[model samples]
Target: MKLDVNALGTFYRMAREGAGLAAGRLTHMTEVETQVGVTKLNFMRGREIRRDFEDATEKVAVRVKLTGAIEGYSMVVFERENALRVVETLLADSDSETDIDVDAGEFDEMTQSAVTEVGHIMNSGFIDGWADVLETVIDVSTPEFVEGVTAEPFFGEVDETPDEDDLALLFQSSIETVGTEIGFSHYLFPKRESMAALLDRLRTSGGIEYDKLDGFDRMAERGAEEVAKTATTLTGIDTSVEIRRLNFVSLEAIPEQVADETLVGVAFEFDGMPSGYLLFLFDEESAHEIVDAMVPMEVDEDGFGEMGTSAIKELGNIMASGFLDGWANVLDTTIDHSTPEFIHDMGAAAVDPVIIQLGENQEFAFVFDTVVMADGREFDCEVYAIPDENDLERALNNLDVDRIEETPTTAEFQELENS
Candidate 1:
């Protein structure tokens, strides 16, 4: 199932720009420097996606049903603390008390109304962007606030969570102000097989340029250079990085691309403004050769022994860290990574866990594949950058790109002032 990478990128851009609008509206209403940015967007299986909210245990969400051309539901879910912060910020200038205790999950009538209004504006921002791109109008129902971790109201009446195979388009956005930041993931559950029509609408609307992620290409290129230099220094093996493929892809497409080939994959989880996974994949032979080069003395079996795995893990950690350090420098944000996990398995299986884990929050994954060469010999290895959608949106917003027009019209600005 090879999806159109261009339309997906356009959709990503649309969501990002839409979030920018939503953030502007929030700032207008709160009179705070609110920054709204898309953090994640993906089309994932319904049951797998629910794991995110289920693990949440408890949270606050504002939900609304969509009607007209598109039939589905839209929601803005916030962490308990951030929801409280939102309430405090919205009511700051009012005569009411401006303090919000972290433990206070319940909001007063005025506060609830204010939050619901924010949700309405955000929902409009997102749908309006979709309408403009697809050239269609979609109406939204009134926003309703609910507090629960199971997401009972959002899913409607069901004796138990349905595990049927249904697609969910999940979009997450983060609302940030000075000294206050909160993230909310929005999910849209349309009828089964609705995506084919949606994608067709997007494609027929226009041919989207597939390389819009050129921003990330530049970022990854710079980061790869850094990783190559660091690897050369650490392993004392002449090394270089050749970026092979860079594009946005969906979860289902990953296994197809990787196929049944076996490889040694070192995985790292990066957590930051836009969190994602970085995988260093190498052929078994290359893994062994690289391990041999890293270790001064190697006389064990040909395959990757305990010592070989540890050496490769260290090399991967160093290279991955160096690479993300470059990204952090370019994006001007902090990014922390998890310990590298080493796996020697089939290519599809190597990435399955990552896809499933990320699937909990998103449907698409950004893949930045690069080949690491040693001493002019092709290592037959790849590096993948599977970043969170919301974080990628934020990171992309930080970069200068040909984004959709985000400024409000004169009448709209006037309306904002009055509101």
Candidate 2:
């Protein structure tokens, strides 16, 4: 259907509003006004439609224009900073400029990439299913009636709905754009070798004590095991798993929170899972320290500013996959996972609880406890199985326990002992 002037304005307004929210800004956008002499064109074998917005502003008197088509849209956002600044301004009333300038050349490249990516998502015909709702909203809000229009779906189909992988790609793209705008090199998956090399350097550089090396090794081993188990379970594989070893770097340069020292946890899920997780655990100080390490000095002079929530969220996302993989394998059934939710400042008293419910009323619970070892003490790790009889039976039924190997009756154990 053709979008009239008012409808087009509404579309722009809605899109810009959403973009403003995504950009973390508050802006007051003037209602989109049609420029004189602008033309609408039909092309691309009845599959594509295009509209242009042009304006000669008094400030620069430049003929700034924006073109939107069926697949995607592009605009020359006055100045490079104005592109981001516009969104920021719309979202937030703050006048703070971005730490790094958006280079015109880079902006063009990234914009083109984003536009193309969004276009492919829209043109996939999956979005057509959502067209009716979109049309309904448009009809209710605007006086202009849409005509000859076939609505598109909502970017993904029932069977081919956008999953975690698609969301991850979009998240990566958004982060890269933000990082590039701030002059930071984006690395979603840091190389394992590089992390290992950094660990080696930290060990030799005397940044960490020689005696603490064993503790670090133990921690790394535990982390690797956790990640490996998770990966195997998720992938339904019985293969051995290997994880990138963890290392302790100097914490002196790290930021402190509430005047307490922080420790950083870094490990990667490798070998078993297709996409691995990067785990970061920190005391308040360590959390700030990592943020300090990541953010440019220009943006955060004291390394005590806001932590990169998006980056941390991505880290959690990766780790969630590994953990889910492990749990699914243990259960021998596939379970869908929602996007990982992040929690910060999780104190010592914080309890991680696992609650399992079966049938109508049977339930069981497990609480995770973290143990700290003394310098001179060696403690063997223990695994305790405390299964609820009813819940266990239910789970056994779900797994079709008949297929799994089972021991003979208690008589067999007594016979073996007697023998």
lDDT string for model 1 (110-132, tens) is 66676677778888888777767
Instruction: Assess candidate 1 and give its lDDT.
Output: 0.68
Candidate 2's residue-wise lDDT over 1-419, tens digit each?
A: 11122232232233323333323211112122111111111111111111001112111001111111121211111222333433332222222332323344343433433322322221221112113323421101101111111212211121322222121001011211322321100001112233233234323222322222222223233433454344334323332322222211111111111113232333233222112222334454434433433444545334333345544444435544544444345435443444543445332111112111111232221111121111232211111112232332233334433333231111000000000
- Residue runs of model 2 more than 4 Å from their true location after superposition: 1-281, 285-307, 346-364, 368-393, 400-419
What number of clashing residue pairs does each candidate have, in the order they appear?
8, 25
- Cα-based lDDT at residue 54, candidate 1: 70
Q: Relative to the true structure, how large is the alpha-carbon lDDT of every model?
A: 0.68, 0.25
